[model samples]
Target: MPAHLSYDVVIVGGGHNGLVAAAYLARAGRSVLVLERLGNTGGAAVSARPFEGVDARLSRYSYLVSLLPRKIVRELGLRFAVRKRTVSSYTPLGDGGLLVGEGRTRASLAVLTGGEREYAAWRDFYGMTRRAAERIFPILTEPLLTRDELRAHLDDATAWRTLFEEPIGVAVEERFRHDLVRGVVLTDALIGTFADAHDPSLVQNRCFLYHVIGGGTGDWDVPVGGMGALTDALADTARSAGAEIVTGHEATRVDTDGATAEVAFRTPGGPAVDPTDGTVTARHVLVNASPQALADLLGEERPPAAEGAQLKVNMLLRRLPRLRDASVDPREAFAGTFHVAEGYEQLATAYQEAAAGRLPTAPPSEIYCHSLTDPSILGPDLAGSGHHTLTLFGLHTPARLFAEDNDAVRARLLAATLDQLDQRLAEPIADCLALDAHGRPCVEARTPLDLERDLRLPGGHIFHRDLAFPYATEETGRWGVETAHANVLLCGAGAVRGGGVSGVPGHNAAMAVLGR
Candidate 1:
């Protein structure tokens, strides 16, 4: 083997976590190198142009931004490029029913529900939880370990009593008279959690707590241009700070010998015999892929067995959807996301079928129209006119797609969605445009088996290190960050403190590396 290219740190995968880690490590004056398998950066946070010439921001797998710390963006000087968006979501019921809320509008529930008693009930539940968020946000951003430190912060007798010992359903039902209204508020309970929304688990309420805790209340925003721009900004920041990035370099194995580690990856243009052409050795290694990705590199010795998993489906629409309501002005077509599931029973049914490894026939889906917000997404010229694009995310498909026929599932999902929208909007499909050269429409399915088989998460569970109820503790969500191998750290969605584009896990892990 040729000589190893030594560095102070080697970050595998250039996703936000890896990029954040690289930036911090480089900022600390440690030599850092980031290896990415794809030509573009940002794993799930990436944006792609599904249609040529005409650009559409494909948040691809992960859509929307919540739980991201404003402090981290500031500290890292990430604000210059990050385009923040406030949320204006409307959950539409099949009839003319709708649940609308904007930017921490829990205070304005009366307006949202039109003076309904249900609005007051939700205000109480959200009010109490939002208050808890104010207290919890600061703690989550910082790293914690000491019992006294954890206790002095989270040991709030009052906060604990309200958060843990309460019937959340009753509390929520009291807030809104409309079951649909209460359902919309509660649906956020499982953004990345594997729990049911109505589950009596205090973790359900905590999901809401964590989202608003970061003080990023309101509609979801993108980082200008597209989701890829967020990664571009991070990449630019890393490179400007003197960090090195090598794309199309896939790390096959991470060889560790107690004290030091070496990463072996194949160089795209290099010879089959020269795998070492791209190999690098480092004092520290950070694994940013799913836990299963780490297990693939580290083997069963770490992560050891299956966890849960999640299925992601992405759709590229030819034209703007035909809504049922023609009276709704086109200008009123906001880029806000719309969640379809309305009540506890609806969510429960979806969850039970999903847990059983079968896709829900009528799945609860969340739809977002990015073109509605930034007409520039269509290009500089189309800024004044409304552009065309749509996104629909369905839940509870088995993580393992190897067994099922993906083509059939995709058609079924698309057909169901069109039918649902048509029934609601009362529109014809002849007006919609399906573009050519966009290549064949395809569906990407990842099953628990895929998460387990490829990502190596336990039982295909994506949160390899869960931080939810029963698993919520100082150590529970910590991932392997503060675990056995002090030099090794886990910094993905599975790690403690939970997932999303928050980048907390990576930021916290970087701090751990610095021993700060």
Candidate 2:
């Protein structure tokens, strides 16, 4: 609700990406305005005390950070930081397990496989990906690189063949022999994607690359003070740079004629703008929403809807659950990704079962503790009492499986998923749950359908759509943010190199506008 009708740029969706664009554009002296439909900014990257009177702030959605660039943090001088977990992951296998960090990774792998071959193979495979990350992560911020250009720049024919030319399953099969090890490696490819190991379409490969290339080390870091800390910092930076961000205003439609455009929005309770009623005009329209939402806003034909394939559960634990694998401490296992029934065969079976329109009999998931790395999210009272937060991410639970009856399917799947986790625990996780002020358990489960209802994510697809390779396609304009309209750009996770918590698309959109 600004009286001014014309502005330099009008951004839709005040998510993290939109805040990045707003901060960059405003710092460059552009009159920028951001419209958000939610009551607060940060979109999915916010932290909330979801449990009543819990005295703990949990990252409600999109927890953890791996892809966010340090360049953005430095450029904006945002007061946000991340803490690294000492352990990378722990995969329970009967009485033994595989722990991948803290100088015991090789020994743990040896125990799991009964040999050192798997450990060597793991080292070699990750070494290749580490190099690829170093070379490929830089391209995300620059202009779009064509497929051939990127392949040649990588300079590793083997890495290209393993990652780009063939399915990730091929590489997983060729590089690793153990079923549990293979599943551990392949889980990254299926985080938010609904694809098989050998899906010829190679969506899993793109997802895998994004996951491994984060921070040039593939290590997912915990955002200090929760994920909302980063978005809050970005919002503060944008505001200080003179960008006006208006929450509770939804951009309904956009009418543009290439050079200049008018953005129409719905304001629940605010005075209208001048000269054009509820419309605001700008030289460029940068949409920080999904691609499907952009097409709808532009009144164009919508693309195929994307389906999300993950189940998220957030829980507050009075104490960490005891593990059946006594060789590893519960603290060490929960500190990193705790693999639950995610063996390679189990994952394949789950994917096939879900593809055939049923929930996986043995659901595959991974759990990690957020408060283990940063106890500050819990106040003095909660932290002093040994309280912790656990986030469980279930795989292969696609949106279609719950289309018939979301609540019923969610309940069934939640029970099955927790059962799988309990198999590896000495005691039930439910027994370790903390109670909120209402005397209810401090645990909540969200299916893909629930995400759509809450976040406006089309079909609950977290990336907004299937992630594309970080290369130029036929539709990829100069910066990979451009649309058919010269003045329109995508600044959200829907952009070509966009996904996860990364702000590449937003930075690229601003760069395109600056002609840099």
Candidate 3:
């Protein structure tokens, strides 16, 4: 006989979002079951020891934490904590670079551009975004607002126009005169999103809005114990609230009318998944997987493919690489975002090249050293021996570029990317790499295709799909997480206003169930 179970709600995919929904619903006296295809939960938000015999635990896929709400943290009593980054970012020019954060941003700006005009514009622009963040972030958990209602919430007409009305590139161009400053501002609109700065679709605008409004202050912080710590806390909260979590259960199908649902699954090496034996019935079903996966489960025709656009490289450096700029310390520079080859013209040229199906001559990328903020992720030996972890995320290298030969393309792309970074550093990054126990260099690169196969992110898109506005659309209900079937809800990154590490989708889905 195949294993069978029943619950008030069955969640397919035990990612952090699913765990959040499970915790909230279970706390409200609802019976919940979370099925995860992987042996462990947390999904992309996980930490792993990639290098052999390395004591360092790196936040593998999703690194920073900014979008998680304090309401969920308090309601669930999660023991998660995050540390503020001292430096905001560092973009290298020739001998001097533009440094942001730690009270020296103005000085750095003045030094680089030889004036305070850029700094003044920077303050005005960011102040606008900060105000917009305060107004827009609080409503993410409540019932979705219509576009007009959202505009009313954000009463500033100029702020609204800058973020929503015209292309984000227009605002960037009109606000800042320096090409470096303009490129730095435009980078936010392109992280994990493949789009031209002035794409008519306004996709870049949507992406820019999400990045700035995170946490109501637009500050992305380092998680205290890596990204896994947050999910671990959520899983604990859900379990304590009487939720059942089953790992290695791949959800195969969901048959549901408007009122009730039955979920079919198959475990690794298990018999064929059919409703007869390997099935569980539930009054409600919440899919915490990608939108494409959700369509497959509901047995609907798959939607258009959403392709991811980025390159991820993780390295265990024996020590931080020295920078070409001798004035700034490596620790301060690497603590925040270390941008390379991302000048405004460079970014535009790269996009044009990539759009034409060729790798950019100079790929734009950012690097972050997580251990500088929280050294606890390192073991005693590694922490004391000056070892640190570096995470590099490359832009403009979309998933389509790796379709023919992922390995060969990845190698060619990695070399070109490192070559770009090498220009900003005094020495090549390769010399600073620590060797694993197997004597291999402690560096690994993951293309979007690697992410697709590993994490089931449809087309390896990090947001699961292109993000939608937080407001209610015609296809959705009062809650952005709603689906066509009343009994089914989407609780994944694919939901509207549901990208990043935020549990907004999960929280909104739970509130929709609770009729809040």
Candidate 4:
């Protein structure tokens, strides 16, 4: 063992959240050290050029920015840039598609539903959610509120009952009569959560709340230079604040005594060659790993099972696929999220199939053209050549489906998912795919198991674990990031009000350490 190094605070996992916490603590003149297992930081929020001889940068795992709090962005003075999509989403139906955007939503819905009733319902339903978002989003930055306190803060019994008390499926079903419209509303509930829309456990409700209330606006924007830009900005902010960052260092164990916490880590190469280990003792320890990872580090029993239920696919396309509906331009349809077989019944069927340990015959997925909104992701040569990038997020494909024969399962799932996507396109999507210098198509799919192996996410749970209600539970007056140990705190997506790229947990963890 080497000599014990000490710091005022030590953050495990150099994800955006950990970096955020380190920046805040270090800015306050507290000595801080950040340990990251990967060669670079960013965790899931990373952008990479996966294809050989390809200039397109893809946001590999987690894409889009919705849940990031603006308060943190402003306070940190980070230089991250995100571009808002002019089109929100475009879901294809029989011959036309349902288009949802900022200024043109009503007209588009009227055209899709072919009537004013469903359009009126859409307006009313979103109106309620907007009001709910206004009331709920502000509370996420504060200390955890009790259930009753949150309800009281909402101040509307109907809004509370619809959003908090009942399953979100109930609200979706009651509000919309059209299956496609209903599915559009329910997709938010099922994004990273592996629960039925009607799950009585209200897991879907919790997911829905985060999706809608992100940044106090339900807009999911694309980071200009790819997701890595956000993390890079965060890293620069932390370094500017005088925080020490050590990459390729994995925290093996965390021991907390009454007075302080100690973190043992293996540097760069494992213990085989580098037999000696390093230790950092700190007054406060902020963990950005999943709860399961934390439990393992603490040598405690595992927490509840966490399994991510989404398959991510990234592809570089030679050109945008032609839409079945020629009336709408391919650029317009692909600019926002393009839904493939994600209707209400279709999503439910896929969920049922996946739950039964079978891949959905027609996977419910959505695709977005990153280059359509921001051309900076591609090299000037590629952009001039009309090349584009597509990111597909397949829902209801849980981690369990890929448990055995991961490659075979991924192949089958990818084929089926692309087939479903092709159904909506005028030409086969594969035909539009670009080729790398090695003559292989520029495409990659990541299953939950792959995510676990690559990103060290337990069971590939994206939010670290299932997202909890932003407010407090029975743990009274406790900060959301507080763990059972006094010196140790969860500053990752597993913490309360934690999830997405918000960095709320990191902020809260630093506040806890500051005794605020």
Name the candidate that leads on lDDT: 2
Q: How well is each residue in 219-266 modelled by candidate 4, as lDDT tens digits?
A: 889999999999999999999998999887889999998469888998
Residues 1-516 of candidate 2: C-alpha lDDT, one tens digit per residue? 765788999999999999999999999999999999888999999999999988999999889999999998899899999999999999998888889997988998888888999999999999999999999987789988899999899999999998898999999999899999999999999999999999999999999999999988889999999999999999999999999988878899999899899999887764775333388999999999988999999999998998999999999999999989998899999999999999999999999999999899999999999999999899999899999999999999999999999999999999999999999999999999999998999989999899999998888899999999888989898788889999999999999899999988999999999999
What lDDT does the true structure give each of the candidates?
A: 0.60, 0.93, 0.92, 0.88
C-alpha lDDT (0 to 100) for residue 425 of candidate 4: 83
RMSD of 2: 2.0
Candidate 2 residue pairs that clash? none
TM-score of every candidate: 0.83, 0.98, 0.98, 0.97
Off by over 4 Å in 2: 270-277
Q: Which digits, one per residue and each the tens of the lDDT, describe model 3 over residues 50-72?
A: 99898989999999988899999
TM-score-sorted candidate list, best first: 2, 3, 4, 1
lDDT-based ranking: 2, 3, 4, 1
Q: Comparing 1 and 3 by TM-score, which wins?
A: 3
Clashes of each: 39, 0, 0, 0
TM-score of 1: 0.83
TM-score of 4: 0.97
- For model 1, the stretches where C-alpha displacement exceeds 4 angstroms are 1-4, 79-87, 102-115, 145-170, 173-175, 198-206, 216-219, 268-278, 302-322, 325-334, 381-385, 400-402, 428-434, 438-480
